[model samples]
Target: MSVRLGRIGYLNVLPIYHPLETGILPMDCEVTSGPPAELNKLMDADKLDVSSCSSVEYARHADKYYLIPDIAIGSRGPVQSVLLLSRRPVEELDGRTILVSAQTHTSAALLRVLQAKLWNIKTVFTTGSATDVLGTGERPQAILCIGDEALNLRYHPDYPHRIDLGEAWRELTGLPFIFGVWIASRESWRQNREKVEEAARLLLAGKNWGTDNIGDVCVMASEESCLNYDEMCSYFDGLVYDLGPEEQEGMRAFYKSLVETGIIDEAPELVFLP
Candidate 1:
């Protein structure tokens, strides 16, 4: 079988994948695009060879995949995309219900960690459609939204308690927040390591080219969203796409928090593609 690659079906990934889309890194392989959760499921089921996979999903099944070296979808601060839109301040939401988007695992887990470690309060999280939940005359103290939806809802005046999960994470741990990563499934890697390495090389080239010309990327990306050129530029500015030593440290901190919260029996070590 040819190498099967997966990409997040969100504009946030354009910085890297845009180059691929523009034929900058031409590779003769099939690339599937979908939401992060769906891609994670595909990776878990051995259906995807490589993917821009969810950070949480890798932790959930680390033995199945190898992290692509020096690549990530993360932010140092104010990631404008993963947000907690709240009716009340975060600290004040103790014992209150928060509606979570059905599309994410990383941000949801991050919220749990923040509540337990940063805010020093507990809040109940329920996963559902916001409109459907509210239609039942239920009022949640907050709602978690990720990707384009979060960007669109971030500025609503009614949500005075808006918190960018990335920014909050920086305040809590003083490190970058990794949302997703490029990974090669070990199943496929064991069968065809050469193909996996080729895919990784092309992806890294795309990442380098795209980040160097964010202006061009912003223009292309702006045309796809409600955001204007400047807004799109700023949004891209808030995102970091590299996984250096510091980024790895940030991941470790996040895993440590997960350990403290008993989300996992222990934090799995991040095994990268060699």
Candidate 2:
């Protein structure tokens, strides 16, 4: 059987996936697309062999997967997609309730760490569909949004104050925030080593190709997103596709913070697929 791969159905990953989909980078695999949270669940349920999943997923289940080397969906600054839209300045939000999107794990944990360590504020976080709050006429002081929804809702009329989580992490620790990483199920890998390696190679090569031909990618992504071509280009510029030394250090820092804030029991060692 071919490797079962999951793709994040978000524009932020367009630069990594566009090449493979268009046959610019040949790949032999079965692919499924969905939100980060959904993909994370599939990975946990052993329904996917490989996926670009929430970094938090691997951290929470470190023993279950192996990280694909030199690739991630992360940013050094201003990740337009994981955002906290607020009715007031973030600093003034102590004790205020923040509605968190059900479609996130990494971003949610990042927000909690920031609230505890950097913002030094005590806020209540409620998890639910953002639509639920809107439907109930409950005006949460802020709401967290991730992926395409966050990008599109960054300019919500009711929430004028925006805090980009990636930028916030940079300010707090001077490091890039890794939202997601390419991971392979260990059980699948132990049985289909060659297939897993091939999948990783295609992803890495596809990432390179996509970034190099970003203009074409932007055009394609624009059709499926609320943003224009120029906006798409600007968004891609802020994203990081490589998990280099600094990014690794940043990821470690994030994990450490998560541990400190009790979001994680301990820092999970990053087990890269060799």
Candidate 3:
């Protein structure tokens, strides 16, 4: 049987999956793209055998999944696509309303963690368009935007407090934040482990090639994200594209915090691929 792979169609992620898109992988896998959180829901419902999932989803379903390595959408600092645009500095947001995009739970929760843990900010989220946060006489003090929305909004010159939340996470933890990871369902791993591993190898090689030829990758990403060449390059370079010890630490910390705050149902154990 062919595998169904759910991929993220974001600019920061596009380069990493170019090879797969070009049909380089050996396995007979179909790639369907969507928001990370949405993909997680599909994976849970068994609509996908493997997906590039929000790392938080892996934590939420730790008992039944394992992370495949070599390719990931991670950032060492300042992922321009995941941002918190505010009128005031992060440390000063208290009792303020923050606009949140309805799409991504991980990005929203990242902002919350920064507010509650690092900035000591007391904030509430109002679900709405990111543009609405630009203060039409009365706007939220800050706005949380992720994925394509964040990429689109970053071009505006008006956001005086445009802060990269991924950069902030690095400052707070000295580690790379793994925004997403590739996961294989337990049953699929047991059934088609060799093909899955081969596909992973191709995915990694493709990303490595993309990185080496960053100029082409940048152009492609720019077109994909509707960003100018410079903006696309900046955001693309911010991502780390691999699973390292530091990124794992950041993922674990985020999971632990979510569990402690009762956001996650339970603290699920980590499972690594062989």
Candidate 4:
């Protein structure tokens, strides 16, 4: 049986998916593209055999999936994209309303964790279109935007206070923050182990190719997004794709914080396919 792979349609993930899109990896499979939340829903419905989904998804449903080792979308420092845009200072927005982008899950959870553990602020969160919130002239005191949208609005002077969630996580925990991970359903892996293995190999190969050709990837991504060439290059430069020992430790730390914040029931063990 052929595998169905879910790819995140975000500029931040371009490095990993560019090779696959350009036929550099040469794999036989059906590919679906969507945001993190949409991919999470597809995986939950078993519509995707393998997908790069929000890291929080695995922690929430560890029994149903096995993480594909050695591949992820993360950062050690400021990820130029994921930002919390605030009209007022972050500390000053304690009792105010915050608008959240519906495109992400991990970032949302990270924001909650930051509020509870670091900021110690109680604020109300409401979900809506990031574009509408930013452009409608009716902006909330704080707004959470991720991916390309966040990258575009981060430098705007209207929102004076911009908080990078990745940077905040690094400062709070001193570890690289993992936003997304490639995962395969446990049932899919058990039934078509060879196919899943082959897909995983193609993904890793694609990521490696993209990393070596960063300049080309940045040029292509810049053409597609509003970010200029230099900004795109700088953005991709800050992103980390390796799921090394340190990233795993950071993932666990994030899961622990999520549990402590009551965002998730428990921090699941990291299980990988052989």
Candidate 5:
């Protein structure tokens, strides 16, 4: 049976997937690329054997998936791509409608956590494309945009109050924020342990190679995305790929915050492959 891999179609994930996409880590597997929300659904449905999915998704479905050790898309501060664009201050958003991006899951949840725990402001939330909300002249009072779309909005002068979620999380919890991780269904790993192991090795290797060759990766990423070479380098520079002990502590803090706010029933234990 062929192993299916899900690739997050965002520049933030370039470092982790560059080698795999550029044929450096050759493996015989089927790959699908889409936004985090799409990949999250695919992985939950067991459509992809192993994929980078929202970090919160792993906590939500802990029993169904196991994390591939030492690989993730995270940030110590100011992720640049995950932004909350508002007409007014975050404190003034109470009872106001905020348009959320359709391309994310973790960022959306993080927005809720911030609203409830940090800002103490409750607002009406709706989902739509950022272009429709910001470009169509029917802009909401507050909007949440993630991935390349958020980066594009940085040039727009109308959004004066831009809140970086990663930065906000760091200020609140004093730890790195893990956005996504490599996850595989328990059943798929049980049936194809070797394939999964090979895939994990290639992934970690790809991450290592990308980290060493970031200048090259940034050039290619700049051509494909809206960011320039320097901007891409700056963006990638802020991202953290290694799921080390400090990152784990950050995730645990995030999970605990989610639970404290009643966003999730409990903080699920993170299980990793041997």
Candidate 6:
């Protein structure tokens, strides 16, 4: 059987799928690159067998998705790529307007969790990229920017106020934030468990190589992101490439928040391999 493994085309995600670059996926399986949001839809539509998807996507389609453990895009603290940039102080954010990135469900859900549990106030939540959103409002109170945009926003001198959502989640939950996970459609996996396991094993091997050569990964990432090597490495440091106990807790907590807010009807538990 043929498998189309969809993935993100970003430096941070490169290491996890480095095996693809090195031709490590089984010959019958093909790897393609796209944002997590797109991959999630593809998986839901049953157009792909396995893909790295946003945890929120799994929650959205609980019946079809199953998590692939020991591999993920997660963060312990201060993940530079997922941030909430505020025009004002975070504590004074009540009844203020905020723009959220339309590309990521995970980032959008995190904003709801923060508003519900910490801020104790909710206002208008709109959708757009950081630039488009910032341009739309007279002055947006805050804007949620994820991926490379968040990293770029950190360097801007004017937007001095910002909060790293990953760090904030850790502070709130004492657990690492799971940003992304590999998931397979249940129907696809039921027919091809052995192939899926083989692909996962290759991914594990690639992750090991990435951890061992972080310096080179950082260098390559710098070029792709246009950040200095050191800046890129610092962003990379906060990254936890595997899903462990802490990340699972964080992921579950996030899903619980969605359930509480009525964003999703129920929490999706992680589906693991024996």
lDDT of 5 by residue, 41-157 (tens): 999888999999998899899999999999999899999999999888889889999899888889988998988888999988899998875566876787899988889896677
Estimate, for each residue in 152-239, the C-alpha lDDT of model 6 and write its tens digit. 7765555678888888888888888888888777777788888877766767777887888888888877876768999888878889
Candidates sorted by lDDT, descending order? 2, 4, 5, 1, 6, 3
lDDT of 4 by residue, 95-171 (tens): 89889989899999999999988899988989988887667787678889998788778877778999999999999
Compared with the true structure, what per-residue lDDT tens digits does model 2 show for residues 1-274? 9999999998888888878887878878899999899999999999999999998998999999999999999999998998999999999999888999988989999998999888889888889877667678777899998888787778878888999999999999999989999999999999999999999999999899888888998888888788998999899999999999999999999999888888889999999997
Candidate 1 residue runs with Cα over 4 Å from true position: 131-139
* TM-score (all chains, Cα) for each model: 0.95, 0.96, 0.88, 0.97, 0.97, 0.91
- List candidate 2 segments past 4 Å from native: 135-138
RMSD of 1: 1.7
- Using lDDT as the measure, name the better of candidate 2 and candidate 5: 2
Every candidate's lDDT? 0.88, 0.91, 0.77, 0.90, 0.89, 0.78
Q: How large is the C-alpha RMSD of every model relative to the true structure?
A: 1.7, 1.4, 2.6, 1.0, 1.1, 2.2
- Hey, what RMSD does candidate 5 come out at? 1.1
Off by over 4 Å in 3: 24-27, 131-139, 155-158, 223-226
Write down the lDDT that model 3 would get. 0.77
